[model samples]
Structures are given as C-alpha cells and as structure tokens.
Target: MLKEKGLLGNIGVQVVIAMCVGTLVGAMMGHSASMFAPLGSIFIHLIKMLVIPLVAVAIISGAAGLGSSHSAGKVGFATLGFFGFTSAVAVALALFMGEVFQPGMGVDLTGVEGLFSNVYADKGDLPSFWATVLGMIPTNVFQSLNEANILQILVFCLFFGIALSKLEKDRRDPLINGVNAIVDAMVWMINVVMKIAPLGVFGLMADAVGTFGFSALMVVFKLFLVYVGAILIYGFVFYPLMIKVFSKTSPVKFLSVMKKPQAVALSTASSMATLPVTMEACEEELGVKNSTASFVLPLGATINMSGNAIYYGLVAIFFAQMFNIDLGMSAYLAIIVTSTLGAVGQAGVPGPSFLVVAVLLSAGIPIEGLPLLFALDRIFDMIRTALNITGDAACAVIINDMVSKDPSHAAEEKVQNA
Candidate 1:
C-alpha cells in the first residue's frame, strides 16, 4: 500500500500516522517518553548536518550557472526588485493577520515553563540589528565557509559568479561545467536522503507529541490558524494579483509552474534545500530566463524570506500577548524593523529561524514567553518554509516579466498558439 502511493506520498501518510500514533502512545506510555525524545533529537541533528553544506553548494552553483548566461546584470537587478517588493508585501500581510486575529489573546502559559527550558538555555544573546547586517560581509572567505555563514557565502558567490561571467569563455566554461556537474550529483544525493524523510519526520513528530501532548495544541490553535491562513492568502491572492498586475502572465499558469517546487519546499521545510529544484522549475517549466532563475532564486532564498519575516513578527507579538506584555506602538514598530532584518540576516536552516525569533522576542518583549512558541515551532516551521519558497518563485515570475526583452511577444505567441 505504501509503495503504491510513491515515496513522498508515503512520507506524508507516514507523518500523519506517526503523529496520531505518537500522541496516543505517549498518552498511554508516559514512562517511555524519554526514549522517543532522544531518537527524535538524533533525527533532527541528521537533518541539520546536511543543511549548511547543501545551502553553500547549491547557492554557489546556482549563481555560477547564472554567470554562464550573458544577461547577468539585468537579471540580477530585476531579481532584487522582485525580492524587495515581495518581502515588503509579506511583512504587511503578516502584520495584518496577526492584528486581525490576535492569536495570543487569553492563552494560558502557566504550565508551559518547563516545556522549552532546554531550548531557552541553548539560545545566546542576540546581536544588535546593525551588527547582524555588518556581519554578513566575510572578513575571510575560508573562515566564512568553515563557519557556514550563509550571508558571507552568498556574498562570495555573487562576486565569484560575476567574475566568472566576466572571464574569457574558454576559461570560464570548464569551471562552470565542472561545478554544475557536482551540483547535479549533490542534488541527486539529497533526493535519495529525502526518501528517508518519513523516518525522520516520524521521529520528530513522536518527540513533539511525547513532550507536548495533543492537549497542548489547543493553547496555540489560533496562532496556528492565523499563520496558515496568512500563507494561503499570500500564495493564492497576493501572488496571483502581483503576477497579473505586474507580469502580464496568467496566474493559473504561474501557479502550475510553482506547484512542484512548492511541494518540495513543504516537505523539506528548507528553502535552501529546495533551491536547485526551484531554479530548474523556474527556468525550464515556467520559461523564466536562466540568468534570472540562477541569480534570483538563490539570492532570494538566502535573503528574501517574506514568510519568515512575517512569522517572526507575528510570533513576537503572539508571545508578548501570551505573557500579558502590553506592546505599545513603539514595540510594534520595533517588531516590524527587527523581524524584517532578522529574517534577512538569519541563516536559512531548520531551527535557526527559531533562534532569530527568539532574538526578536527578547528585543521586543519578555524572554520568558519564548517557551510557548517552541512547543508549536515545528508545525509553524513547515508552514513558513512553504510560504518562503512560494514567495521565492512568485518573485522569480515577477522579475522574469520585468527583464524579458519583449514580454508581449511571448504572451502573444502563446495566445495565438492556444
């Protein structure tokens, strides 16, 4: 039965089953909770181990591929514009959703103290916003690579890609091709690893259920609903309208091109992991120019996290409300600024955004309320990942329309053929 459904299909089914089974079993066998927690931690670490290298290689190779194409500069600017616009819209939507629903009103957090103590202990103090921004520029390339600093890696990739593009064709071709081949192999390896995602997800789900129990879900139900609802609005309404207004392409066609990448994003819950697939889909399936996809998607994945930004802001406010912290206009303004910067500066890895969310919360509200969010973090992480990738693709489409030498030509030809 599982085999008939295919790998990802089975993985999804397994995750649902695991969550249900874990909840029931944990409730029954409370004594065995310790065992399930360690297993889940191990699985999460394994996923974490793959993240830095995968992001570094994928972004570099994607940028290098863009360099091979001739229109790097125009494509780069259009991509920047797309990211800026979409990110702004995402923040707006998050604020709107957070305020309209007020996901944290009347939530009880008295018993949640011990729930996230370990998580809090692991988190260090947050650097100032300017410091975080300044830190993105690597002092030493090797050191940055060793540290797996995503922003530094991205800066290096951009310059290296541009330099490669500026080189003589013969000199650049061999290097670019070699890098591309390695990237392809790495992507294949990732796919193979992801086939075991069900196991990993099962472990993670078991741990969550064991620790929090299903009853704890009711505490944050409103926040969960708001987050999911906001993402859906961004995906269906905001993105399509942007495409129609700015791109001159049918929203339906754009969504079709985006489906596969979006699915990959939801499963992996890492935009960096989904970059290779996203770039490919954008270029081949969506007819986005290679130069555009190669440059835009990778860069966007790193810095253009519209979804994450919104999430951080909403969570900050949610936490404040839960703690009975009255956030005035200044605090809300601080949230908007800090969350936007934090999302861009934070590394695109699992669990890292939570760190940034922690930082934002500390700066804007009381840190004691952080634990409440940790209980529901994984569920929201998956939703945020989906939204992040969807934003990336939507930006790519908008940018593609902007930079196409003749957008009307392609649309007219397609219309005539249809």
Candidate 2:
C-alpha cells in the first residue's frame, strides 16, 4: 500500500528527486542550462500549436449553440456573470492569502536588478484603462482572426451568437447542425493531440528539473504551496459556498466531476489547450447542456482565470516582501485592481502574466524584485492553469443547473454520481 501510494500518488516527489540529481550532475560538470531548454520549448510549442484552432472552433460552435437554445441576452449575462464573479473571488482570495502568509518575507534580492530590467525592456508603455477597453474592438475582423486576439474573437463571437439567435427556427437548424458536425470533428482531433500531452508534460518536467535543480525547486516550492493553498480555499471553500447560496448544488459533487479535467489542465498548463477535454467532461460527464457548456467553457478558457489572478496577487506581494519593501494597504489595493485588469488585458498572450508582473513593478513597486520570482513561474503556472480550468468547469456546472429543464432530476443523477 505504501509503495503504491508513493509511486502513483506522488509524481511531484519523483520530480523533486530528478531535480536534485540533475542539479548535482550539472553543478559538478559545469554544464549549460541550455542543454535542457529544448524540451521545455518543444512542450510549450506543442500546446501553442493546438490553441488557435481549438479556441476558434470551440467559441464558434459554443456561440452558435447558445443562439439555438436561448435568447442572446440570457447567454451573454450568464457568461459575463461567470467571468465577473470568478475573477472577483480570485483576486480577493489571493490578496487575503498573500497578506496572511508573506511568502517573500526573508528572501534576499541583491544582484537581481539587471534580470528584471532587461526582461521588461521592450514590454513598452502600459496602456491606459480606456485604451485597453478600446483595443478589445478588432479593427479588422480577418486581421484579428489571423492574429488570434482572444478578446477580439470574443467580441465577434458575441455578435455572431446574437445574430444566430435571431434567425428563424427553420433557417437555423441546418446551419447549427453543420457547425456541430465540424465541432465534433475538431474535438476528436484535439483528443488525438491530447494523447501526446503526457509526453509533453514529462519532457517539460524533466527539462525544468535538469535546468534548475534543487535551488530552483525551493523557490518553486514556496510559490507552489502559496498558490495551491489559495486555490484549495477558493475551489473547495469559496466556490462551494457560492454554489450553495446561488445555484443550490452539491459543491463536493461538482468538484469530483471536475478532477479529470483539472488534471488535464495541470498537465497542459494552457486553459485554451484544455478546452476540448473540459467541454467533453462538462457535456458528457457532468451533463451540462451542449449549448451552455459550449458557450461558457470556451469563454471561461479565454477570460476566466481565477487561479492566475490569485497568483498575480500572491507574486506581487511576494516580490514586495523580497525587496524588504512595504506594500501598504494602498499598494495591496492597487495590486488587486491591476492584477484583475491585467489578467483580462493579457489574455491569450504567452506568459503574459509574467510580463504583466514586470509592468506592475515598473509602474512603481520594485522593478528589481522580479527575477527572484521568475525561476519558479513555470511551476506555479502549472498549478494556476489547473485551478483556472477547474474554476471554468465548476462555473459551467452551476450554470447548467440553473438552466436545466428538469433541474432536480438532472441534479440527482449528475451531482450525486459526480
């Protein structure tokens, strides 16, 4: 029993061991970290490759399905509410956790100034709030499509879905049916890609271990614990309470159905990349209507990053602490506001959270405290990504419960079993 538990339930333990071994060899031989860089790059690329098509098809199909079932207003409100509530909760929880723990309290920040200064050099000017809002409107539809701008894609989808909802019943069926077929095919392709995901995860993990070793692991350990603890509180405590109050569902059961998809998100570390699996789990396993699942999950993948938002707060406090700087109440408030907006502003851009951290620091705070945190971003990113995806799935379940025709019957079979 002990052996099986250690072997099957503790991949993180094995990863630590690998990191120790790799670091010892590299240190002794004076080897370059570049030797292990390729694996991480390849894993990131594989995820990026799947992102564009997966998002486009998922959003389009979801939007179209929403149009077929309900008024555009209902669909729009539900999506907005889910994103808004989750984002608010995420930011609040992260701030609370950061204040209580102070993970960066004792870290030394000497000699790290150049690392952040160089990293943030070309990040350019931080856009104003109104400008960021304006940028959400795509100047050119095809250009936005080619650029894979998620907010732009979402804007287009909102209009497209509303138009589809307005179509006569007789005219809509054939179009919806055709799009559904294409979506089905695309989902299948995503599954085929997923079979390779474990390999990608393994390579990424191995390379991270090989390059950074135990010292990096310690930094990651601190970030990981803080981030994971915040997620558990949110996922298990906060979200469940919201479920009870607003949706009247079993949060325990909701989380159970979410486990498989959460695992997929952690392994992939990309919410958009995990959408195909999330959609399947919500529709088939959790029994959310396709219309609701399609609309909510894709939008959640793009914008609903509860975990990432939390990480942003925690890391911002973390860097402040490392620099022996006091982030007064005002600063914490600023972080809460900025991180929430930053999460939205940087959606669909690779590692934008880290870049946003640099922006926040440069805007004031301590610009030099970033590299102390960078060594562990990849590790916390995996956890944040998983939590983000879980939040998305949980919201889908709650929304489905609200809109189901036979709510109690659907709840009994799905929630109880899940």
Question: lDDT of each structure?
Answer: 0.68, 0.66
Local lDDT at 215 for model 2: 55
Question: What TM-score does structure 1 among the candidates reach?
Answer: 0.85
Where does model 2 exceed 4 Å of error?
Answer: 1-33, 68-71, 109-118, 121-126, 209-213, 348-352, 405-418
Per-residue lDDT of 164-260 in model 2, one digit per residue for the tens? Answer: 6568978876777776776777666655555554445544545554454445456545656877899888878877777677665577777776666
Model 1 residue 64 CA deviation in Å: 3.7
Candidate 1 achieves a global lDDT of: 0.68
lDDT (tens digit, per residue) of candidate 1 on 1-418: 0122265445555555655676666666654664676655655565566666666655566666556444456667777666666666666677778778889888865665565444454463567768876887788989987777888888887777767766787998787787677667666766765665555555555666666765576677788888888888888888888888888678998887676666556556677777776777777767886656666777777887777877877777677667677767777666666666666766666663555545355445655555666556766776787777777887887777765555554564467479
Q: How many backbone clashes does candidate 1 have?
A: 0
Please list all clashing residue pairs in model 1, or write none if there are none.
Answer: none
Worst 10 residues of 2 by lDDT: 1-10
RMSD of each: 4.7, 5.7
Clash pairs for candidate 2: none
Error of 2 at 282 (Å): 1.5
